[model samples]
Target chain A: MPSPADKTARPTGFRVALRDARGHLDPHWWLVAPILILVVCLYLLPLGNVLLLSVSDPKPGLDNYERIATASGPLKVLLTTLRLCAITTVISIVLGFCVAFAMAHVRETHQRILVVAVLVPLWISVLIRAFSWLVLLRDQGPVNDWLMQSGAIDQPLALVRNELGVVIGMVHYLIPYAVLPIFAVMRGIDQRLLFASRSLGAGAVTTFLKVYLPLTLPGVFAATVIVFVFGLGFYVTPAILGGGRVVMLAESVSVAILQTVRWGFGAAQSVVLLVLTLVLIGIMAKTVGLKKGFG
Target chain B: MTDESAGQDIRLYGLSKYYGDFRALDDVNLHVAAGEFLTLLGPSGSGKSTLLMALAGFVEPTHGDIFVGGSSITALAPEKRDFGVVFQGYALFPHMTVAGNVGYPLKVRGLGKPEIAAKVRDALDLVQLGHLATRLPKQLSGGQQQRVALARALVFSPKMLLLDEPMGALDKKLRHDLQLELRQLHRRLGRTFVNVTHDQEEAMAMSDRIAIMRAGKIEQLGAPRALYDAPETRFVADFLGKSNFIEGKVTGIDAGIATLDTADGPVVHALGTRPAGIGDSLLLALRPQKLMLGPGPNSRKATVETAIFLGTHAEVSLRCASGLALALNLGIENAQALPAEGTTVELGWDPAATVAVRPD
Candidate 1:
């Protein structure tokens, strides 16, 4: 039988190039072709459509973007979204660091229990979790009832249908995302370095502050970016917990497209959110460097 | 580099540690003199590293006290004890540069910026790493990282320097070079140094005194030369270096000289403190280098089984008529004139060359 190399020798130009490319390509690429096709058809195609609609619909060329800049409603929604995402990122990261540190240092049996506690929420549906938080934080909810019964307040507190409710729900949803990366980095840190620092005249607090914290910074930074980005795109939890009272960017986009039937404006808002998230990630990557930050 | 006089003596009184039913350290009592270099030499499970950790305040003894400069420091935290420790793999902070790592201890002490900078520079220069001050620990080679660890540990002028197998991760050549450098550093700083290692050669090379441990107990403690010359037990003799044992019965004693009757014949010698009467069994420890291949006052006829030429000396294995195996370190000059393997020869040594040791 003639070798593929021999067969390729007879082909000219384009055919030869195609044959050569096929011969050199990895056979394993065939295994991933299905997933690649699915990503292009389901993800990239819709994203491209959104980008096109942002400029083409409603007479094209920057009208929706100008409205986003000049209109008060869209601007207020943008600010609220940014504010809620920032607050959620901070609270989730701080809580995640404490939980990750505890999990990393705890006994093996206790670590398993803590890990399950952090991961169980991820397995539950986001809508279900948001609904549960709504039920728990409402005026007639268990928390408010308990506070009233304990004589801490004369009436049930206003806990849901606001920015505070949106923040609480988003933080609850994003904590596992924050915990995983920080916990991974914390586990990789050598425990002996802590002992070395302590033995070299650093007290427990000093060792934790200087050695342990710095070594775990890469994890913390990665977790922060992940939580912030996830919070920026969050819709279900904020929509359910906010009870239509606290309108975020995602809720505004839905209102523009479904409630008002303004497709170009909704698509434009989405494009802006996407660009903003990318720009934030790019700036962070440039400043901290993904490699060094993770390491 | 700041002060050569900054060192404190350490003492352990009946120090012991237990892991459930297993005893890690058993009633260890040792006195490390100020500015002295003492090594804990033992096999892997002999608790040498545990003893070093106890000294560094990482491992708490179950029932005893550790005193530094005549004050009991058993309950003091490791940082308060002010003892510098170089771990097995050095444990340099990967995120910090060499200068930053060296300055860490000073920074923890709340030293001023200029003072910390000067001290960090001095510490790095002392370790000959001043040029690599800005490089992270990961960028340096193993030996360089080890030097950085040494600089960091010594920057704060610690009371005592505890090393837990500091050279265990280096190659043979690097380990040898670091051993010499460490010895010189000990001499220059005049700091009390407590090093732990399983390598007997390293212990003998750098230690002023060595405590040979076995099964959680110290079998012997003395200077390197003393330990090599007179091991107290068969375990110590075997662990420190090679030794040949001769089992016999004590036939007579006169003027501190005891005559022993072996299966082959009666051998006379005066060594060891164990008292023995007639018909009592005793063991004798002999160094192979001391045994000569010729007829002397105490001589035995043996057949050579194998002879290996080792450049300066030839190692010969021999078997006597009574089935006793012996090893001899023959000089190259004498070995050149010796007969080939399977040949009969007479082996002898001076009675003073043998020492009495308790059998394991």
Candidate 2:
């Protein structure tokens, strides 16, 4: 739906047609050029600055990158970040599959209600959700008090300010991301396929494993990539729920730059996170093989 | 063609399905013999698919029992019933290749890898899709996908096969081709097939017997020729094919023929399986092709209202002197040709040309 002025502005001359795309740019480039310029000025230049600072600010060479493997503290932070992100992604995808399956099968009215329930938490501030979890899950919280009153446990359980709390907060924040893509895939699946599988002599479990599971795998893969990448950069939820005990990569980067004034180290950690996320996406994209699902 | 398991006779006794107040399937009692191909032909909401689903065990009837070879299977699950159902959309697993789709039943049966591979190859070859074994379902054409669905349904060698509008999605030429292939496959397999469709022509072409349903009830059940020539009800007469009805009252009886007094004239109707009494009031159902433009035992002087050329025949619409409208087809042999519109023409037919049907 381009304007008539836009249509007339295109180079429709024979000279332009003779030249290939390398010189005779298509009109589509006009729309993209502004966004490209904005991204370069607002995002890429800052990212380049970080890259430059990471290598040059602290005595040059591979000193900062080398410390990731050499130093135990930063190495543990990296390990903890990977571990929490993985756990959160796995938990979110499993729960999201169930939620999405229900949403896909239910009547339209019920499905809409369930969708709103899943989405409401996403629209709420992450800081609020994290605090709510913190308030409910703390050692002296109502959960522990109820369990103790019910004679299930004599002592309170440590639920927050740990790796478990960070994982819980991250998974809660990411379930919406997981559910949407999986639900999109599930909605495209014809219910007759399940009936066909059963008619083919496959029982419920076998049909699910062979037919239903494979059909929804693309959505699962998409959710996994999405949730994992989004989880990698989490700052507020982990900071509030972790209670400063658990150190994710983003928190570590913030500490280096703002608190410790170690800009080079912060830039190095950002670079590491970016490179790792891109690498993981590359591996997953290959495994996902875009041509297969939703065809 | 494998003799390990042959077709079994399926019986539905007092089968009925009620959705709240609407009856999806009324008390339907049917017995399909071994190796017989029966079709449930009806319009939407007439319960044809509902009956087929009940037989497949996907739908549980409100009160009835389904038996295969004298054993009741009313309470059995769809998977346990051991019946293959070809869905309307083919429902080929998009994630699986053609070979994978056909071999799924065998795999679910716990067959070994090599055995499943060999059987899959045979099934693909049966459908003439051996070259496209590794291709996904979406890669193939509609006809190829349909054949793949048929192959997958037959690969398990089930006791019975149920098809729900197998050719509903194909174009005219494709539907015609697949109809021939399906008939041949049914012959080769020799399995009792219960197909469901609203297409009268498809049912008439493929089915050995058709159960025409209406309003969740079986209006009539018989061979295609028997149903067309001698329908018991007006619905059946009109549904099976095009038919012209003349509202008449029986006035006389002679041998098998019954004379009915109509506004146009006294028309003679040949009594069928359900004979009409002398004083009974019933409608006469006449085939369009049977009525000719000439004088006969039962004749009507009519004005030609309209004439449409239909390749091999011309369909003539007539308005009789008594204001009775009628339609008839004149074959190519009618060298007299169609009379001009608004012109007078004499229409006639023999006693055996029309059947007396109960008004529905």
Per-prediction RMSD in angstroms? 5.0, 4.4
Task: Evaluate residue B137 in candidate 2 and report its C-alpha lDDT on the 0 to 100 scale.
Answer: 96
Give the Cα error of residue B351 in candidate 1, in Å: 3.9
Candidate 2 has a DockQ of 0.76
The weakest ten consecutive residues by lDDT in model 1 chain A span A10-19
| Docking band of candidate 1 | medium
Expressed as tens digits, the lDDT of each residue in A1-295 for candidate 2 is 7555554454554334433444555555676789999999999999999999998877787788888767998999999888899999999999999999999999999999999999998789998999999999999999999999999999998889988889888998999889998998899888899999999999999989999999898889988888898999999988998989999999999999999998888889999999989987786678875443222
Clashes of each: 0, 0
lDDT at B33, model 2: 86
TM-score for each model: 0.89, 0.90
Model 1 residue B147 distance off true place after TM-score fit, in angstroms: 1.9
User: Every model's DockQ, to 2 decimals?
Assistant: 0.69, 0.76
TM-score for chain B in model 2: 0.96
For candidate 2, write residues B202-230 as lDDT tens digits.
Answer: 99889989999998888999998889988
Residues B1-360, model 1: lDDT tens digits: 335566788989999999999999999999999999999999999999999888888899999999998999999888888888999899998888889889998998999999999999999999999999999998999999999999998998888899989988899999999999999999999999999999999999999999999888899999999999988899888889899898888888887778888876878877556566777788888899989988996798999999988889889999988998998998877868755899999988887788888899
